[model samples]
Target: MWHVIIFFWLLYYLIKPKYSRRSLYPPGPLALPLIGNLLSVWLGLKKYKYHHKLWQSWSQTYGNILGLRLGSINVVVVSGKDMIKEISSREVFEGRPDGFLYTMRSFGKKLGIVFADGRSWMNTRRVALKYLRNFGYGTRSMELIITEECLELVKLRKTDAGQPILVNQMFNISVVNILWRVVAGRRYDLNDDRLKRLCALVMRLFRLVDMSGGIISFMPFLRHVIPGLIGFTEMKSIHSSLQAFIKETIDEHRASIDVKNPRDVIDAFLMEMSTNQENAFTEEELHVVCLDMLEAGMETVANTAVFMLLYLVRDEGVQRRVQKEIDDVIGKRQPSLGDRSRMAYTEAVILETLRLSSVAAMGVPHRALDDAHLGGYLIPKGTCLLMAIHDLHNGEFWEDAGTFKPERFLTKEGNIIQDERLMAFGLGRRRCIGEGLAKSELFMFLTHILQKFFIRIPDGDPPPSLKPVDGLTLSAKPFRVIFVER
Candidate 1:
């Protein structure tokens, strides 16, 4: 029958490359005929909270930079901070792949900032940064916006004090509101049903990317044949829902757009579209860009805050020290950005949290624009590159890297030291566009929460596992906390 013929054809097509073109690639496990190293790589990540475990184990035998064959594509993972930093900065390595899922998510084109490359990415990033600054990206106004939201978060927690509460979800409202204000010129109420749905959908989308090393991201073809098996159906539904929401927001901005008087990121983007007809900024692109920023901003900081709280919950001494630091520096009045420099311990806690739990453990997939040499290995153009940040952080970069010691980021003079090794937001042109805003928001939220409440494990329940759940972000499992009033 035709089915058997097609099966043989696919087998021959997949197996052909292993015999002929395997020599040019960097050394990895000898891939099997047709499937390559797909099964091993997939099975390797099936059991861990962080995918870096699998890569770190492989890097020992194959050097810091080694390639793996996933399906028909070749992927190179870079370990250790030095190699990750070098590979991440290369201009030739700045391009993104045209994989089915990558393109499909961005409306069948690399239209937005996250999955885009070349001139489109360049133009969009430049314009977005410029206008986002005008909208209070790194200024005191931004700090105030975040602080205001933090107050809402505190109020919400106070309402449910001493109850078994999912602190991460509560943090979600405040974090989303800050970005919502900056990007959309408005803030959703903490109890708004729309805000909750939007945040949940975005979180689910990222979690899908974490399962089985995000098999669907590169192997999107499986979705066509076996959507349920591959998680493509859920991903598509979430994307469609998010897209519709973004479209409505953009349409609202379009109707009320003023040339001289821009409101937020949406209006600013519209103004740019009005003038820059030649660039890649379009209505569809705007939706993706908004979603990109929203998706990046919402869960990352919240998850981090939860991680910090997990540490605080487990280590009461450190928790008391953080609170004491907050008390000495900022007192009872809302913690401001100005207090950050003096609160070295609090700053170190944030830095350490980022180091220990790198939310985006693997940097977004980077594709080679042309044949390139790295660590003596030739990476062919279109080869995918991954930054195993877990290995990078756990390597020789930090003394006692396995421990949760914030003092590593502190000096003898009690000042916070800035290490280039702490690359949670990444490096170079493709680094997180909202890093400035995110840092501001994160600092404010953590300080404000610690100032008002003591984060503790819930009563009459077994202590939940401290190991983070594997996802696009390394996050605490859904464990409840009792926020005892300070």
Candidate 2:
């Protein structure tokens, strides 16, 4: 057993980058012998916000860029605006880490836009952007879909009138509908078994990744040997389910392709496939892209909506101000993307919610393709780079960052000001593709819900704690809200 352990240790040392030899690597907690810093972020521990707290503490102790070890992997955590700009803007550090879990769970055999690096990523992203533009994402055509989803969501909330509703479910359903329209060109009923299972699986995976201490992440060698350590069985099942669903959807779209009038994203992708038979445009690639859209688009929008609703319930002053803005502009009509400018305060509320919530607290990890310098620290190639988005949201960059004040986004005279410090959608080339869609969904849904109902916290809870449950996303613990009919 000892010899076997020594052999694996030697192998890891050989394979991993030698960050310790680098003179300029940022200072951080001293990693233990073999375990590295894995024990500090144990996944099984309950109610621990190590990732968030660690980033906060590290920023204070070691400056903007801090280094740590997760087993043999060199992890670089970046905070502050200057450091973020320096890292994300560069092409070399643009790619994400190539890990076993990410490959298996996200890409599998498919080459989607999100996981595809270099030329493939560039091509896929270009096609996707062009297609989205053609489909009227930032224009009138997409607003119709957003309008329909918001109306449906508002109607559904009426059922829970005068009672606290789980806002997460409502947001989840609404966001899923929007993503469905974008991806598959069809929406599922709220109680659909497949939809429920898919949402649950995605949520579970988010939690796992946020707190992943699985053998695959910490000890890759034991992934096969220690079968129980990795959540392979569960992950495999989820992957199969997701792939099967995506494949069927793609097949249906292919069989009923109408070139003259493309229905949705799948139709657009099929058109791309027909035009570009060669290169990376495969059915497998198409499947992964659809999955990425569903997974990324759904949870983020939903989580933000939930946060917005929670804040509204907690703060009556902000709620009334937001509702007043909506009432003045929208009145009895359902809110749409067109009303964004007219509803300034409503938009401010959503922005403030994002600032406070910081969903996806530690923004997606970027891997250094080669040696990079930021804040006087050397970030060697293949080091897992994590951006402390939460710190930025709560840092000195914004006036009273910790407070949930929407007015900070508005001038004293009430003109709206766009702050670049709001890095919730991230920055630079790899910034979220769905930023426009997310903004539309967030604004439309929040306006409709607020206009239709008065939200309030339940009797006992203290405003559903602003402190988020740590993971890949900054998720709130299960909380309830009362939706009083307007």
Candidate 3:
């Protein structure tokens, strides 16, 4: 009798015209009683290619900026570029949404530049920007580091000697080297145990966080009650390993601090901590910030390089053009940041790769703090906004959006034309702080590798399916490539 009553109540709620107040918001499939539209969205959890397909279908049926209930939680997916701009620019929508996974991971503490909001985010971002600028992000200091890493990458690939190499591994090593230099002022050995463990833990955490149907995300209390139900044990183990690694590194930096000159990110952070003891920034913040920087920097750059490799293997013509340009301008020597202007085709290829492959498919979600309007729709405060980067890469916004033609980026007269619609690093005030570093890393590494080796699908294997793996970051599936020495 009680079950019947509850069922009828839920039915009534579903049929009721409660959401009529916000009818102007984009339309979507009618959410059912308790489960809502979660079942439909969660259908492609196992296969990555289907995940984006599901979202695309939803947008096609409902219009851009559609709303749905993910097991009682409101999920607003903004597909259009104009809507993304409006939402991301507003303070009301500038904050990240509260989730069980985030709370558990950080224990409600916003440490890294990625999760920190408002004052902390602003302060940390400003500090990081200042430090990166001084460290030669736009200048020549960091470019030297990138060039060295690329050189090391080429040597490493040479060892494989025209055989299929897992390009992802090489990309990971190069990215980790760049990150290690920025954080600790030195690069790690290719076989460093600590670096390997750190990378593994980060990859695991990313997988856990990206999974859509995690119980912890919806039911925070389950973290305490059911424990195993939320995968808290694994989460706790990974967090402990990462936290310990960060704490030890920071302590080492503290012991070796040279007041006359700061070394790396740690040295700069310690200097700030010494001057500003009263503020919220603490040793704990420093530890988490280092962890955040490593995780964010590694995953983004590695996935990007992997995507570029996939494209090169799949399209021989595009590969040949880029390689020809590299050979003409850079010759046998490794490419450097200084060579970026001379290598226009290579630069355009990088841009086109970012466009064709949407790495950060649905960018970090933002919450609106105040009422805002975008794309003929009024977005109320507290509304969650999702920027669909994948949609932007396909829509009519760019000429020949479907094609992987780098020539589109080149002017009719053969000049590189910058396109603002490429928001892989995101847009507005909250754009990626490490954009300069990431750009340099991608350009130099790709040029160096292509110059020395020709990448092709492994013998007896079909061309790597350009399909991306699903996660918070859209990663490429494991594929091998033959590196024929140039």
Candidate 4:
């Protein structure tokens, strides 16, 4: 049969001698006939928690700067701090790839800030960030908003709680409220049907992307052929619903537009669109841009905070230290950015959690704009580049990186020692634009949490498994805990 012949040919391709001196690509495992390392990546994704470990191993064996052939593209992963910094800084590495799944979320075009590139990326990024900051995104006012949300969460939490609930779910609600206020100029209630639905849809998309080994991204055609496979059907259905909601929200914003007194990000963008037709400002662009902010703003820091809390729950000693630090600094008062300096241990613990989690493991891949030479190897134009942030934290770069020791980030004098390697939010020209706001939210929420209650295993229970579920962000599996009052 033809299928048998195809299988044998594919197996022969894998077993055949690989290209070596003839190719200029960096060293990596042998690639199969047409699929390249697609099978390897697919296998790794199937193993979820250990998938990152696989990539780390390759980085170790092939050296810090190495290449991987995933499907039709070649990826050069930079793991060394110096190499990543050197490469990510250049504009040549600032482009984004146009893959199937990557563009599918954007209505078959590169319309959003996250996956956007070149002139449009620069222009949109500038305006969006400028207005975001103007609306108190990273300032003291934003700190106050975060503090209010923290207090709200404290009230919502059950004292002497007997059951372990999904804290990240609680976090998503609060984070989305904050982001909604910034983006659309309003916050939603915990029971708001639209808000809850959007949150679920976002998680679905993240899970689908992760489950597919990102194969769906490059080989998007597979979705058309096998629509029901890999939760693809569910993801598309959810995406459609989310698109409708986004469109509705945009129309709502339009109904009450105030050009001179733009109320929030939506109003500000509408004003800009009204004035600047030459720029790529349209209703579709607005829809995707707002979508990008909502997803990024809600998930990144919130999930990172959950990872931190999960670790704290597993280690009572760390939790105690965090509480003691908070108590000493603020003495039961609500904590703020001002308190962060004195509470060095608390900050260190959170930072250590981020380094370990490597939430965005390999950050959204960057595309090379032009052919270039780096690390004594040629990087072809349009080739994809990935920064192995996870590998950077391995013991080779950080002392005893595998161990969860917050003390490493602290000096003997008890001050938090800042390390450039803690680029958990990333760095260079394409670093996360929302870093400042994310930090503010993380500090306020976790400190207030420790100030209010003690996190612990439920009575008559063993320690819960801390193994994280894989997705766009690595999150702790749903586990129960009792919120014992301090």
Candidate 5:
């Protein structure tokens, strides 16, 4: 009798529905036991190639707040602008997920700002922002550094002005060097082989991340079961190489120490670690923080710039209009941060690029710190919250949502309009810390390039495809452009 009862229990467990018909969670498709919605998500990814698109498709059936269970994890995808803002602003929903992929990046534990949560995350984020700001992040002083790098890029590209050159990774070195200056007190030459390798590693890192956090993130046992076949080895190798590089840089900073005069962000962090004993500011934390800076800053800014250029090249009329604006205000003069105000059309172009490209398609996943109600449904504690950012930008709020129209962000009076619906940098507490620096770089780099060159599609070549190569961030497909000197 005991054996029969045990057998029935086991069978029920294997075939049970993860979400019952009378569940309080938001309405969603049926989720199977153990696997839950993994198979459906996988199929969606195979069809759409982007998580935001997949979630948008489901939202059509289940309304804005769609719920699901991927293995043992409960996920709530919040679409619609108002609902996204609600979740983004709530304190109870600011936690980051502590899954295997997140911890694996920080040595088998959550340690950095991007993945860590609670008190430690709060402290690290506070310190990082304070120090990064002190080192000229989002400041006028940093504008000069970006200007210098923009000049270098302009000089390098001048050599191939008439020839078709691949522009996909063109902005990587300049963008990374700008952040490196703040983080490490140095910059890399555009041709540095080390910079090339580092950029490759960063690129590979983004590709490894699945829109649904990968199979290993949910089924972590796969690492132990089929480590070689399941990309575990490659992932580990990439992370180890990146950490080693950051460690080497930190060691050099330690050798040439200056406590009183903090040379850069690393110096500031080191000083904090030395003096503040209460926080979880360790050497490992420092390494991971620096890695976070590079990976986060490099991919977002570089790819967005490339995407901006891709759009401009495809639309010569738009390109000419922007150049006209650049010519009208600050023509042939170096573009300072102040110039950004008078250049409304140029600002609109940047805004349109961010809205259309939506590099961070899903943005970083947020976790529910406590069980809470959103969109008339219960989000249990430990549920992963995915803010459908791409959907928000392209959904009902905007007219001609799919078209690349900078004018959509502009008013009839020739002024830039600030639409709250465009949450490209995300919203609330976990909003990207590099937003200010990113905007500065985009304005300066784009203005400088447009002031000097006219980006054109090469003769006899087809127009570049607007379709993005999807991954962690939406990347522009490989294409070449001729930078004709104006």
Candidate 6:
């Protein structure tokens, strides 16, 4: 009789819902037994190439705070500008999800600013930001490096002038070079084979993983069963090679460290590790932080700049207006960061690109640290939180949010309007650390290109579709442009 009682108790415990639907938890689509909403999510993602859009579709039916279950994991997607801002500002929503795929990126554990949380994330972010700024991350000192890359890009494109030049991943190398210089005090040659391979690998890594962390994240055991079939082997290989590259760079820096005068971000981090008694700063942490820098620094800015060019090519009037602004303000004088302030319409174009592109669409998933109340729902601890940033940027709050209009970011007086709804880099403490540098790079690269060349679609080829190719970041479709000299 006791054995029968014990068996029934176990069954009941196992079969019960994690959170009561009849309770204060947010409403969502019905989740099936064992699988929860996994199949539904997969099918939705198939229809909508991007997961944020998938969430947006569901948000329409269930309202802003839509609850979901992916296997044993619970998810809450916060949409609308107000809900997004509420979650972003709250401390409980600042934690990073501890899923299996997240561990795969950083030596079988979470160890970077983008994916780590609590005191460790705090210390590493604070230190890295401090030293990165010191090494000309957002400062005027970076202008020379960016300007050199801008010129290099212009020179290369000039050779293919009036001809079709595919720009799908064209800006990757230039953007990576700038990031490498800041992180390790070195730059890659434009035609270097190693740089080309690195660029390809970075792009693939991002393409493989989506904002939802994929099936492996929820069902990690499946990797051992059918690794190659599900992309586990490839992702592991990519992470290994990328880590090796970062470790090699760190090894080179370690060999020639000048303690008093640090050369770059690596040197400063090493110095901090040696002196800081806090156990947070480790070599593993350093490796992961550099990896974060590579992905965050290279991917978003590069893709955004490319998307900006794609938009310019599609709309000649917008393109010519931007060029006119550039011509009016600088007049062929070597463009500098200072000119961004004076070029209102040009600045508006950049802002508009960020708004419309919405790359990093989900803006790095945040986890709920504790049981918290948000949007009048009971958010249980250990729930994965996703801010519907794409929705926030494109939803009804704006006037015709779907259209790409730089004038939306400008007032009647032609001054840039600072809208709280435009959260390209995100909001709150966990916001993108490299925002300043990204803005500077976009301003420098775009202005330099527009000033020297007229971006046009190759003759006889229809205009490139403005629809983004979905990935971890929203990428512009394959498109070519003729750099007709101005």
Task: Give the number of the best model, judged by lDDT.
Answer: 5
Better of 3 and 4 by TM-score: 4
Q: How many times do residue backbones clash in model 3?
A: 7
Q: What are the clashing pairs of model 4?
A: 164-480, 164-481
* Candidate 3 segments exceeding 4 Å error: 1-26, 33-35, 44-49, 211-215, 224-231, 371-380, 396-403
Question: RMSD of candidate 4 to the true fold?
Answer: 5.6
Badly placed stretches (over 4 Å) of model 1 are 1-21, 46-50, 211-213, 396-399
By lDDT rank, best first, the candidates go 5, 6, 1, 4, 2, 3
Model 6, span 40-92: residue lDDT tens:
98888789877888998999999899998888888889888888888888999
lDDT string for model 4 (1-486, tens) is 999999999987776644332166777777787688878776765664455666777777888777777777777777778987877689899988776666777888887788899998888899888888888887777787787778878877754255666566668878877767878878776667778778877865776664223676656677778878755688778878878988888889899887878888888888888887787488888888888987887877767878777788889999988888888889966788898878889888878988887778777778888988778777788778877777776547677766678998999999988899888877787899888777778888889888988998776666655566667666667766677767
Better of 2 and 3 by lDDT: 2
TM-scores of the candidates in the order shown: 0.92, 0.90, 0.89, 0.91, 0.94, 0.95
Candidate 2 least-lDDT 10 residues:
41-50
TM-score, candidate 2, is: 0.90
lDDT tens string, model 5, 339-395?
989999999999999999998888788999987888668888988888888887887
Better of 2 and 5 by TM-score: 5
Please say which candidate is ahead in lDDT: 5 or 6: 5
Predicted candidate 3 versus true structure: per-residue lDDT over 1-486, tens digit per residue: 999999999988886654653675556777777666756656645443455556767787778877766664566777777767766676667876666666455656765678667887788878876766665556777778788878877787787787767666556657877767877887887667777777877766766654332456555666778876557778889888888877788888999999779988788888988887777467777776777777888988888888888888888998999888888888876577888888888889889988888777777777665666666665666555677788888677777786778888898878898876788888878788778788888898788888888888877987777777666777777788988987
Kindly give the stretch of ten consecutive residues in candidate 5 with the minimal lDDT sum. Answer: 14-23
Q: lDDT tens digits, residues 1-486, model 2?
A: 999999999988976665455557788877788877677556413334557766677668877788887887888888888788777799988877676666785554425666567777788788777776776667786788788877877777787687767666566766777667766778877767778888888877777655222347657776678655566666778888878888888989999999989988789888878886666378777777888887888888888888887788778999898888888888997677778877778888888999999987878778888887766677778888888888888887777777889989898878888988788988888899889889888888788778888888778756787777666787877788888888
Instruction: Report the candidate with higher TM-score, 1 versus 2.
Output: 1
Q: What TM-score number comes out for model 6?
A: 0.95
Cα displacement (Å) at residue 92, model 4: 0.7
What does each candidate score in C-alpha RMSD? 5.0, 4.9, 4.5, 5.6, 3.0, 2.4
Better of 1 and 5 by TM-score: 5
